[model samples]
Target: MKKFSLLSNRAGALFLAPGAILVALFVIIPFFWVIFVSFTNRTLLGRTAVNPDFVGLQNYLALFNPETFFTRGQFGFSLILTTQFVILSALVGQALLGLLLAWLMQAVPKPLKAFTETCVIAAWILPEVVIGFAWFAFLDYDNGTLNGILRSIGLPGADLLLQQPFWVIVFFNTWRGAAFSMMLFNSAFQSIPPSYFQAADVAGATSFQKFRDIALPLIRGHVVTDLILITMWTFNVFTPFILTHGGPSYRTELLSIYTYRVAFKDFEFGKGAAVGVIIMLINLAFALVYLRIARSRNKEAEQ
Candidate 1:
């Protein structure tokens, strides 16, 4: 029996070895490499390309420098813009709208609920390139579908991308991501006992009252999870580049797009690595908070 157990363990190790090696080569090594590069003056062009010098903290300092910190196209500006984008698109738009939709679906007819879910999920599952181009066509100024409709209705067409690029991406991201939150909240709501809502109904509670007093409390953990996940996803989303290319003078340049522009576009590998490190740290903080909340929830469940 002991010999068989040892053989089984060896077999398991053999099965896992390939995956473990791949992870170390792709994920772990690259992670540390980025950190190391951040402490250098590396670039993809010119002198630094081949003989990059160790300029510890200079890249980070330049990112936070007082002279250019708040300037347009700077790191600080992108950070602030990314913060606003996450708050508006993830926290406010996706979470709130998803909660509302989930609540409404509970009282909706089955067919309507299914149809709504299908439509929302379609938005989520469609290819990003397809969705981006579809939106661009809809929002185009001269010959777009939206402008055509507006002209037909005697309403003036507005140049949304050029005029309100930030809000455009916010709306785009909200529409793109709300399906996940909606589905999560829907599942959370389903986990809730019907008796609680029945009791609320017996007490002549309104829809809003039941949602506020009963549903919300039951799904509080799910809400926290949804918010954290969506915030992180929104923070790192680069799909908006397809829509606006972080353009119209950098109005919609979120941190992800900013990093891409710095690293790949400008070939400033060191500075880009610094920005990547900061983003990683921010995501780490979010992950830590999420784990803490999840652990507490598990403890409560156990108790």
Candidate 2:
């Protein structure tokens, strides 16, 4: 029996070895490499590219420099913009809209519920390029679907992308990400026993009352999970680049787009790597919070 157990353990290790090696080569190595590069004054089209010097903390210091901190196209500006984007699009828009939709779906007819889910999920699953282009065309001021409709209704068309790029991306991200939150909340609501809601109904509880009291309490864990996940996802989202190109005046430049422009466009590899490290740290914090919440929830469940 001991011999068979040893053989089984060896087989399991063998099965995992390839994947472990791949992760080390790809994920782990690159992670530390980025950290190392951030300490240098590296650029793609410069002498530094050939012989990058370790200018420790200069890249990070430049990002936080007080003179340029609040200026447009600077790291601080992008960080603030990304924070606002995450708050409006993820925490407020996606979480609230998704929760409402999930709650409403609970009382809707089966076919309507299914159709609504399909439509929302379609928005979530569609190719990012296709969705971005479609939205761009729809919102275009001239020869666009939305403009045409507005013109038909005797209303003037507006240049949403150029005029209100930040809001445009906020709305775009909200629409794009709401489906995931909705599905998560829907599952959370499902895990709840129907009898609880039925009891509330017998006690003359209104829909709002039941939702506020019973449903909300029961799904607190899911709500936290959804908020954290969506916040991180929105923070790192680059799809807004397609719609607004972080442009017209850098109005919609989230951290992700700012990083791309810095690293690839400006060819400031070191500064970009610094930005990437900061982003990774922010994401790490979010991940840690999520894990802690999950562990607490698991403990509560076990209790």
What tens-digit string does per-residue lDDT give for candidate 1 at 1-303?
Answer: 445464587888988999999999999999999999999999998998999999999999999999998999999999999999999999999999999888899999999999999999999999989999999999999988999999999999999999999999999989989999999999999999999989988999999898989989889999999999999999999999998998988889999999999999999999999999999999999999999999999999999
Model 1 clashing residue pairs (backbone): none
Question: Each candidate's TM vs. the true structure?
Answer: 0.97, 0.96
RMSD of 2: 1.7
Q: Give the TM-score of candidate 1.
A: 0.97
After TM-score superposition, what is the CA distance of residue 278 in candidate 1 from its true location, in Å? 0.5
lDDT of each model, Cα atoms only? Answer: 0.94, 0.94
Q: Candidate 2, clashing residue pairs?
A: none
Candidate 2 residue-wise lDDT, 38-66, digit = tens: 99999998689999999999999999999
Lowest lDDT 10-residue stretch of candidate 2: 1-10
lDDT at 213 for candidate 1? Answer: 93
Q: Give the TM-score of candidate 2.
A: 0.96
lDDT of 2 at 70: 90
